[model samples]
Target: MAEDPGTALVDQAVGYALLAMAGLRADALARATPCRGWDLGTLCAHLAESLVILRETVTGTPAVRACRPGRDPVAACRTEALRLARAWPAGGDGARPLAAVAATEVAVHGWDIARSLGACRPMPDGLAERLLRAAPALVGGGRAGLFAPPVAWPPDAPPGERLLALLGRRPG
Candidate 1:
């Protein structure tokens, strides 16, 4: 992990989110992701929207408008990522958990995007570790059913795969 886990998380999340979307094509919008019931387009929109909402929650700002028509999910995500990075206070301890949420959303949804795109790129281990530490608090609180029950992973699996398993995502 980096010196500041929060900043590192945001950096990792934004980069991966963008990378995942870069692989998206119009023809693939209807493709299935690892996330059940959500297609590629729907997951991308959710990830983009989540970033903006998370930023507002952490920055004490009013909610911004949802991604409107004529705005692609990738573009919206990039814009919100930049805005969130700027609005986020430096060394704000209270916002650390929010950062974790932002990172987790990006990473998990990045996985969905990548899976749909057949990219199969490895997720950063450090980011996965941070998300794993934050998961119980974020998902166990009132978000119970937000994720399915955790699946088992082999002990020798990579860090990202293990983290996804803990988050109830079955990583192939």
Candidate 2:
């Protein structure tokens, strides 16, 4: 029904990884990103913690710490990318595999980071497009009424831009 939860999960994993790397080195900790006023470093740390949660979910294990904690957040995120590239954890009709979601997250967050750097590419196109298509449901079902602005999306914008615009970031 909803985007095979695994898909979203995996996408997020990938997205954060990309964000961590693609975001400007200086800006990675200072620039504002789509997640509102949170700087790049904070965003990366948040994403890193998120991945740890995903890893626990995928592994179906009981997690003590939600984030990697004290290690270099960026390096921890990069390590996740490497592992996720190798294999995604799967379950529930095989639709919400962790790897797939991780990939999607990586690509989109990469785009986000690129935008912050003023250097975004068009993406691989396919994955970004697919994420654009699914993001509404993924975002809407969970928290549409929670944080979206009173302003709606611009009618003619691309889906990625529209999605970012909705979240308070200028899209690439």
Compare the candidates by lDDT and give the number of the best one: 1
Per-residue alpha-carbon lDDT of model 2 for 51-101, expressed as tens digits? 666666666665444334566656665665555543454445643533444
In order of appearance, the predictions have TM-scores of 0.87, 0.66
Per-candidate Cα RMSD to the true structure, in Å, reads 2.5, 5.1
Positional deviation of residue 91's Cα in model 1 after best superposition, in angstroms? 0.7
TM-score of 2: 0.66
What tens-digit string does per-residue lDDT give for candidate 1 at 7-121? 7678787787677677677678788988889887777677778877887888788876557887776667667776776666667788777788878887888787887898887
Which residue ranges in model 2 land beyond 4 Å of their true spot? 1-28, 62-70, 90-105, 141-147, 150-156, 166-168
lDDT scores in order = 0.77, 0.56
Q: In candidate 1, which residue pairs get closer than 3 Å at backbone N, Cα or C atoms, i.e. clash?
A: none
Off by over 4 Å in 1: 1-3, 141-143
